[model samples]
Target: MIVAACVKLVDLRPGVDRLTGAVTPSTTLGCSAADRAAVELALQLADSWSAESVVVCCGPDRADPVLREFAAAGVDRLVRIDATGAPDSADVAGLLATTLAGLGADVVVCGDHSLDRGSGSVPAFVAGALGAAQALGLVEVGTEGPGTLRATRRLDGGRRERLVVDAPSVVSVEGSVAELRRASLAATLRAGDVPVEVVAAPGLVVPPTVTTRPWVPPTRVQPPPQGTAALERVVELTGAMVERTPPRTVELPPDRAAALIVEQLRAWGYLEAVPSEPATDG
Candidate 1:
């Protein structure tokens, strides 16, 4: 069994400085807490199943430090998809999904969201690319058997849903589950030697767009109102012509009020117009 964790290095702020209007050549990048939890969960699953644990990320060389940290902690393999940065989530997801498909990943884990582009859509995109089942935004992850993983999803109104995900599935976890464990000094030193497998990324596929005229409502043709007097035309144009029954206030005996309500209900189609029993002379 192979378990792969999808990790990302996110931008700390906008590239352009707002005050100076100068291009901020250097942008800070780091792993999100949710990504840390994702790696930890992958480690747990890999350890439990005695499967190979792999961490894959798409970023420039600056991501090496964070990748090494994942290695030191316990990942068996580190994969860096060749990319400086993705223009959008679609590109990143494509790169990661292709890599995982080649890896023949039986289980794919991802963070609920990233620090940048927090739509939490990469997992869904990856799953769609691989044609695999996806269970996202899970708070609890575990295994009920050798081939299926059990999870709990947190929902609105303090609601929770339990689900079982089988192998060849994609799962996303929230950051609140557990904090990532620290790597030991010895492990860190050993990780320095671990090789990061770099994979060439596919070209980004931007959506096809065509520039055209700005939108404007089409002119609608309407027949002239019959015998258009200025007053009638004004009323018609302003929509002051009324058709619905006007509201009425009625005071009646209890029995009569009840009958009136029933009659109105019938008129409004709320009640069936059942036929009254035929009156017979005794």
Candidate 2:
């Protein structure tokens, strides 16, 4: 089995101030901790099934570090996608799908979400584009043969659900397997000696949707949430829970809270007032 892992390059640290007419301050997007963990798990599972190779797919601008890490962590190949520094999710997804197709991979893997967008939609979109089944938010994946893959997905309310799907499918791992392994001195020295050939796809165009906006905001660090702040948080939480009820607190002076509650309930389609019946139809 040929298993491929897809990762996005993400900004390690965003800038405090933005420069005029430059690439967006944010750059270098990649797998989150959860994503990394999932990749590791997927690799182990593939290894169990005697996978032919494990490939790490990433963009040219920001893929070096991840590729180096994958090389050190025992990946057979690093598939490079010629992505610009600020390509959006759609572009990345499309590029990834194309790259996997070219690689003749049997299974594709990805982090559940990118650090930048956090939408977690690209993997499914890529799967759909490739005409493959998707098993997302997976914690465990095992394969019986080249054609059959079984995965344990994380479901709502902390439950695990098992799914069986055919290969050439996309699976997004939900968490990091381990800290991205730091490069050893030997690995770093050897990486320079190793040849990395980037397969560049010509004339791949990704169009923008919304207009780009300029202006930047200042950064401020808030105080820790403890002491008086903790008490205030408890009070705020209690107040919010209280607000959810149609019946108001008894402590408030007669009818104000009740009236507000009634107004809210009516607006929310929960209550309607009925007129009293006229006496003797007068």
Q: How far is candidate 2 from the true structure (C-alpha RMSD, Å)?
A: 9.4
The root-mean-square deviation over C-alpha atoms between each candidate and the true structure, in angstroms, is 15.8, 9.4
Model 1 regions more than 4 Å off: 13-16, 20-28, 205-282
Worst 10 residues of 2 by lDDT: 16-25
> Which ranges in model 2 have alpha carbons more than 4 Å from their true place?
18-30, 56-58, 145-147, 176-188, 206-282
- For residue 107, give model 1's deviation from the true position in Å: 0.6
- Local accuracy of candidate 2 as per-residue lDDT tens digits, 1-282: 677777766666665434543443455445587667655655665677677545555466456765666666656676676655456666667777887777777777778887867888888988987888888987776676765778888888999999998887888877643444455778766765454447775666645534344776766795553436777777665565445536545565668878877877887877976576778954
Q: What do the candidate models score in CA lDDT, each in turn?
A: 0.85, 0.68
Put down candidate 1 lDDT per residue, 68-91, tens digits, no spaces.
889999999999987763556778
lDDT of model 1, residue 140: 92
